[model samples]
Target: MVGDEGRLVGGRYRLVALIGQGGMGRVWRGVDETLNRQVAVKEVLLPDGLPPGDRAQLVRRTLREAEVAAKLGHPGIITVHDVVRDADVPWIVMEYVSGPSLAGLVAQEGRLPWRRVAAIGAQMADALAHAHAAGVVHRDLKPDNVLVQDRRTIITDFGIARVLDGSAGTRLTRTGAVVGTPQFMPPEQIEGGDAAASGDLWSLGATLYAAVEGNVPFDAPSLMPLFHAILAKPLPPPRHAGELGPLLEELLAKDPGKRPTAAALAVRLTALHHPPTLRDPQPPAPPRQIHQRSTVTAPAQPPNAVHPPTRPAASARRRPSTSAAPGGPSRRTLLLAGATVAIGATGGWWAWKSDTKDDAIRAGTSLPGHTKNVYALAYSPNGKSLASASEDNTVRLWNVTAPDGDAEPAELTGLFWALAFSPDGRTLAGGGADGTIHLWNAADRRLVGTLKGHKEQVSSLAFSPDGKTLASGGLDASLRLWSPADRKLLARLDGHDSNVAAVAFGPDGKTLASGSWDNSVRLWSVAGRKSVARFSHANYVSSVAFGPDGGTLASGCWDNSVNLWSVTGREKTATLDGHTSVVRAVAFSPDGRTLASAAEDETVRLWDPVEQNGIAVLSDHSGALCSLAFSPDGKTLASADKAVRLWDLDRQLPAP
Candidate 1:
């Protein structure tokens, strides 16, 4: 029985009405008996066939997730208050948000204007940046998880995705539990890599695309063909998306590393929102291939030469708006001679043409902002800014809106190993060789605070999803959690046998993973302060990251291999071997479909981790690379070595 009216859950939440229902759970509008306040309760219905151990694991994971989700303090994010066990199932008590979901709005209103969609998308991206900064990844970010209140978008169901990840074997799916709605899911999610922050961004992009285009990027009736389409099919250009088409194409890239980051996407979306420009209701012209032999010349216009008005293209006549603004077609008087030549010229009267332009890399695209070797690079949450840390003891923030120019740079006393921005983009955190982590005001480049707890050089730093806690791993083989707000050490996680090189928190902030020179990756329960599982690597592990779904962990090692592990069993699932030198960084694309590995071999390779097959290899860097990062949308990949090499994945990678 789901959401039975009048039934009380955990002797507190009394069901008043059933609000929604899905394959795994049902939501109810209820009243908290103890607090006398309205609340939304999600009841998870576990499949009866689950074994005792699996059931227990799912329950434990849910409880842990609920606790972490309660900490996410963001206006755009839904609030989870409690997790209670009732009638052998878990009931998640969430703040009752009063509004219809974005999906519902789309269904009722049809396709939204691009401007409206952009505004909504920008807000969604801002929420995601907040959740990510707090170390929380909303694995199932779909239209249903997004609620519109007072014209503002709010993301709900903050961190309850673990139930599906744990039950993927039997109970969680009519098909397979893909960590999200299949229509909006990235190819990575279907391919079996855990969804990462990038995954959430991908789903958000898909949602925005659907809002404006009236359907998902990939629409199929069944699972098998839909999976194929998501993996192999080219993204059909959005007919109604117009200016948003390019952004959607980048977001829907089969390669996760090619997608834009949430910050970058937010910036783009905000730019689209200020003034709405709806595309004229007409199909776009297909790209016509032209021969290289065709002559293309600039029209003559000497010192004071004046030209007469020209007629519109033949096909463009169907939609007059194509030649003019919404007001109406321009009524300029034209000279017949000039008008005749404008519509007809080369190829024996075939429309005037030019050779097909190659979409290849050109000179001056790369930004050379650092003097010495660049060690780290991070995009601000809103995506308008970029911060690059160099070996020259300087952290430079670049206004990426104009990548060619440099903004003011911040001078640090020591070389920094890690750099991360707060969710709001107001604060910056930098970990240094001096065994201390420094915080700075992003706006003014002013020093704010310094956290000191590590006895050795800090190797990595991550801010929790709520931006309240900062986690740092050091060469001393310990992970310390600090409260940046209080300037106090919260807890010290000691389990690694050797120097800790990397640290990453799961989307829900329940698990903190650390990689060490001891050749192991250890997962620790954040609240319990204990190591939950240990995964072994052949050599020293250099980087560790939890997939967006928080079910899988990817680690890069000195043995020139990247390994994927199941977080539940703590077992190695696959070893990706291709790089000739030590693998320094490993990242799962936002959707979890593509795994990107960077190494000292001077190349970065994208792999289908589930299939254990290599995809594309990025070899644009000039020297051995030290780090690699995917933009939130996965459309662009940034690799740092002697300098930062930004690969436009859409144009750089071969067609599927």
Candidate 2:
């Protein structure tokens, strides 16, 4: 039986609902509150009336299973976040893969295409190869243990799998108690033989057979007959296998040694999925091919880290998760998570496309257009275009990088409060006061779509560094992530007490910072789709920004102060004081060396992040500065007051 939905186990994992129930244990959809991420928790249930000694032994085995799973670092395998021992029982916490199991999908759709199955087989074989390389062999491999999402296949339930490392290998079966499913077990395994890597391959073959045929290759109504069929019965030919027939036959070969190695099987399956395209037989040189292959395989060499966004480190090595101490600083918490990819997997302050001439930007050069107070401003990823949203019910785009005087900005009518450009600079998203988000094709400036979900007014919007997700915060007190490509709501994040005013994605695209009128600044894991940490503010948080290095987060508050936080320790390292009134906007230069903030006092202040002191103040704006943005190249700054104005940081800030 599963525990109560709200039960908190081990002071970290919170059980929300039972997602899966099996004879061995129960799986619950849960949350890791400290990290504010959703995770799957599997609670191993000791059979009723079991002897105390047996229960202890089972606990040890379960823990060992989790340890083996944790050692596996592959994109195709589910990541183990933590293993908790509660009430003398072990609970395994793992990444929550949101996808249907192969068994479920096959059952729903009545079999799958052989090409699709082959592709999935390739991924699974790769993951299993990784496990075998770690000296761990999964005793039970079946369609039910694999999850499928798009082109991604994730293998789960390692908790029920066996580890074949050293002395542990001797405990394959205690007193002849059989393990593994009958239909998927290899012939040697059915005869009570040790589980080997080849046995897993046999299981994989059986799974593929079922996937394409919608039925197990070998099934019997009784255990004795099932064992007989697995050990002595000839392999059942698959009708729907098509091109996969030869591979499937090789996998189900009775002689384990005759079966293809996991790596070799992956190559063959991948070939079937995508047959070789005719090309020059010589192809590229060996040296160039090696270089290219190295780049691709580097990300999966380590266990998936929760913070794959941490550049260089994610590529160099996999680090253990250093969970924050209760009531202690949460610095390094982001890095502690296993990264899913290498350096390019995520970026810092992201890559900005810039073509602007640093010398062309000048201080106090106003780009006037908005008929009312400009509330938001943003520089396109290329730094060639500038977008401004205002209370005048309009959003305008400017070709700021043009060599000649502005040919005039393109104007779109909408009651907007916040504006952001997709990382590719192809889409312009504007948060409307009418509680909707409007997306425009940047090339033709045509209204492409509208995202409606927020009930109150939408105040802030931002795109993930990858541009795959669009995040918006609104007066509804909720932050929503949308797939701009499909105009579909992906997830809704709720926590703020009042309105959310600002949203920004860190350069790595993993951490998201949002400011709220609730007087709080919250950091979220965009991948995990949950709030990670919160920074308290003295007053309403008006705006938020992240340094390009991803090491620092800044928030402007209504109390006329801007706080610089060290993401490493969740500590406020600096309190920048100079604005006489409320600070409306805060931004960091592309290089992350300088911090910029705008206030209603008609000034934009530049600060030396290293010194934690104000560097210079731009006071030429004729009205209150409501928003601020730095061009991609870090050479220019754009501020919004009654209209948008440019400042050339390259010509340099005013002398302090």
Candidate 3:
């Protein structure tokens, strides 16, 4: 049975400090008074409100699982000392190993040298080999579960994950319920099939993938897509692990029968290099600052993928031909991130003077509802709706073509700061001053869900072109990615030194650009889960946008300047300097021929990016423009001040 801190258990063991927690329960650093030595104690947490019968069954299962783990004897496996109970709950005592986890080590060093990763993998594989022979599978293998003590690897929490093994007639979990982290879970586990010895190898591959690449191989943005990727998508080929790509592929084979045996894996891993010699362990190092790229030599050619030769041809398709979710592009239109589409190579913005027959933008529609300043505006992907947020704690959805032209606003407890539409246009998301994002059904204007994590006001929201990921920037100086479908937070990106003002997805959906009040604009490789480049600005960067082709990036800043950049070269290309006040928002026209920026000077300036000169200025608003967006057709532009204004571009073009 478990005891609180400082409480004596089993008449001798005294609980001290909690060292770790997981699905199983909590692991505490304790002392065995009889032996005068420190030990690790796992307190099995029983769920409350369970029926007495089920509670008794769970207790029995916990002891049985602990017995299975206690039988294994290997240096790479943590040694079990004893199992006891105080009040019906079981506490398992284990030999304490003082060191940091492999995950902790990777967090400190970015990524270890390939040679070092191989040595650690070899020791882990050998340990798994011993357990498999003993009929005990470490079903939940991950970087956080593996500890490095005195240069030797120790795999912990074995045989405890499946306390209520379904095969043993236990029903603790519902049928087909997944039990581990999806990033490392194999297809079999996702399918709810029994986890086998080969499943451990797959998770091991994923761990090694993180150790070398600094991210997961699949890393889907949400629940449905993540499950789909594990079941359908081929594993992304490694980029920095030279000569080890094939091994990773073999270990990650979709079919268990196709994977290499643990013995074979051990041979290959040991052949890479000898393990490091034991030394006096120093204090654990601080977690590695993430986003720092490793120094490993990148491959001259794209990393080669090694698919199984016997897999069915049907399994090789990128994505199924199911009809797209509402407002989503066709499956064929979804491009692979690996395909290199050249950005702004030679077509510097072309000059096309407007003819006498051409029309310029003319302000037409005005919508006033907010009692205070409007802070953000966005046009739905289908161009049929507009959403606006304001300091008055409300987000209003507008049916642009409604005969009455008025829609009920969604009220929030906190002031609204940012707004965005999902790629499919069925959902609208708003970021509030409370640091939470609220999602609404655009078609019905009903509340969908709320995502909460950040501690400061959320400042901006952007959806990937594929409609799979949502990126939100906050005044807390952090950026987070979410899956709009199920509201799953995919990743939390931290690097901005000050408030993040804006976020936008590249046309391909593989790259994301974020502008921050820190006076910097950062480019992130979404697939790689790391910031690839950073561009400096003279003052606080307030807004960012990507060109129609994803080749050029634009940023508007408080310095009253708007700058264009080449996404390929990561260098500034041109600067437009006509605004006299803070440039608040920027948007690229659908045709990529013109750029639009809003400013606190109460004007929206159209610029020719290549000429680096202003094309025209629309000064129809009396108040500062806080946000702007171009309709999907590019013929209409929407801007927000204290009120929202719609301008018809085709009717207001300047004549030649």
Candidate 4:
């Protein structure tokens, strides 16, 4: 038993008020004298008859929880303040969050709006991303652990599941003892297997299902039956009361791999409520028909199709022949048989190709080519030329459209670090490590002039929609605007405290967005050359771009994530987390229907901007991929690493 007092057990923490009580422990809003802050102290009284070894294991589990939670820090995660021993009892001090749990909200309101569920789910996904990155998995993720307050959703008790990470000997119950709450345990977890990140995903699915439908998908009288049902039964889709049918079906898929991750699921939920807003009025291109051809070899057949003579009518059996024909069959018979075989093979090959001709795209078509990592890639507005720059100090221009349609790439080179093409498709501008900006004629591939003024290596380059001004940022922590025609520096804007990694001109060309290594993105007035607003981030910003409508700005960062923000800088619209390494670039499609992101993981991922799900991943690169671009026609996407790759969006897979 514990009491509210200045001293509890041995004066580890002064208890103020009881926050929550669970089956295993009591949480109190307390004051930690050493840390000088209010903290949530969780106290678990040891069972009176507990084995000595089990008590030791519990102590070990408590200590491990402290170690794990201390390493993780994210807005969506509850902070662990400290851990202390009070006589025989152990307690964990966590940041005191004054918020209502999702369970409390559901209990009070009965159900939540789909959009609010999506918003909360997205924040939980971000928290999971952080925990997973730190090699910690939350085995018990429930509505009770989700704190929602002040328009923010936070995931609490991040490391309490360390108890489940214990060795088999440390487990107190039998082999199939009940662990997680039965209603939310995935099929695999119910079979006495260890819980993994996938299990948490299933729990999230169950939680969301409950939130949307106001009931649990599976309910039973006891834990054992619930476990049996989870392991042996298929989850029924949510009741058809409204529009949650499709979303529930996807969430409860039997195979964890088939189920979408939280990040992907959030996007689907978003699309359900807020359909995509198309920027351009043009419709998508008509589907393309692909032609396929093949050649096959045929095996020769015997000229005589007659069956071998059987044993004489079960009476007199004839002996087998002692010797056969010299080459087993006559040459004329072989030639005739071969000709027949060839005819049959030709017919089959033709039929096969004709049947599957509509699908001809091959895997691994994209190839990487730079000596060092590729930093940027862009396709000309006409969609005939592709340009890429790399850390190896070289830029290569590949004729995207070959005259013969099958001709290999033709490379045009310069020592460049970033590349972008003008809106009119007449010129290509490249920023270089040599502190020079080179312009080239897009059609003839002729070098024009170098704009020289920057005193440090350029990191990013972008052109305005009208193609009047080019924005460049570099290691000198300054942004320079240049006039492409005259190759003259228009203005150098300086305010960033660290190197600028990315710069973009807004759709209206009135503002410029620049992201820097100092973990901030600043909106600047292009004409006035002054900062308007600064958006702070937890990690270094790697890339920045404006959405098609120019109302939202998207930034990719070293936090292994991407975020969308409103132009007014009021709130974050969404946070996308899937890349396993640093995200280097983010690009929205011309139609704004898709988003392309390149990361240090050596792959370019295609995301449905409205849906938020990653639809395709191009992974031919063997080195870090640093840039992404889409063709103006929206039929092709280009990704760059050491080499550049062009993916044909028009290509389709064959029907099974």
Candidate 3: segments with Cα more than 4 A from true spot? 1-362, 408-414, 651-656
lDDT per residue as tens, model 4, 509-614: 9999999867889999987889998877767788998888888788887665667777864456666655556678898877786677887666566555554444
**lDDT (0 to 1) per candidate:** 0.69, 0.73, 0.73, 0.65
Ranking of predictions according to TM-score: 4, 2, 3, 1
Clashing pairs in 3: 1-85, 1-86, 107-288, 108-288, 359-652, 359-653, 360-652, 360-653, 361-652
Ranking by lDDT: 2, 3, 1, 4
Per-candidate TM equals: 0.45, 0.46, 0.45, 0.49
List the candidate 1 regions with Cα displacement exceeding 4 Å: 1-3, 168-179, 276-656
lDDT of 2 by residue, 75-122 (tens): 788999888899998888999988999999998999999988998998
**All-Cα superposition RMSD per candidate:** 22.7, 24.0, 23.9, 24.1
Model 3 lDDT tens row, 1-656: 23478988889889998888876678889999999999998887776566788888888877888888998877788999988987788989999989999899989889877778887888788688668756788878899989998669999988876564443443324444445567888788777678888889999998988898888888767777987887899989898776577788988889988775554465357545332222236455334221111111100111113211112123121211111235542211111221111111111211222233323322335676766557888888887778887756677777776643465555443467788888788888888665789888888777889999866567889989889999999766689999888889999997885668899999999999999867899999898889999988776798999998898999987666777788998787766665656688999888887788987766777766655555455555656678898989887788877777776565333332
Question: Residue-wise lDDT of candidate 1 within 189-234, one digit each (tens)?
Answer: 7776777887787788788888998888887888789888878988
Residue 112 miss distance in model 1 (angstroms): 0.8
Candidate 1: C-alpha RMSD after superposition: 22.7
Residue-level error in angstroms, candidate 2, position 370: 2.0
Error of 3 at 363 (Å): 3.0
Please give the RMSD of candidate 2 to the true structure.
24.0
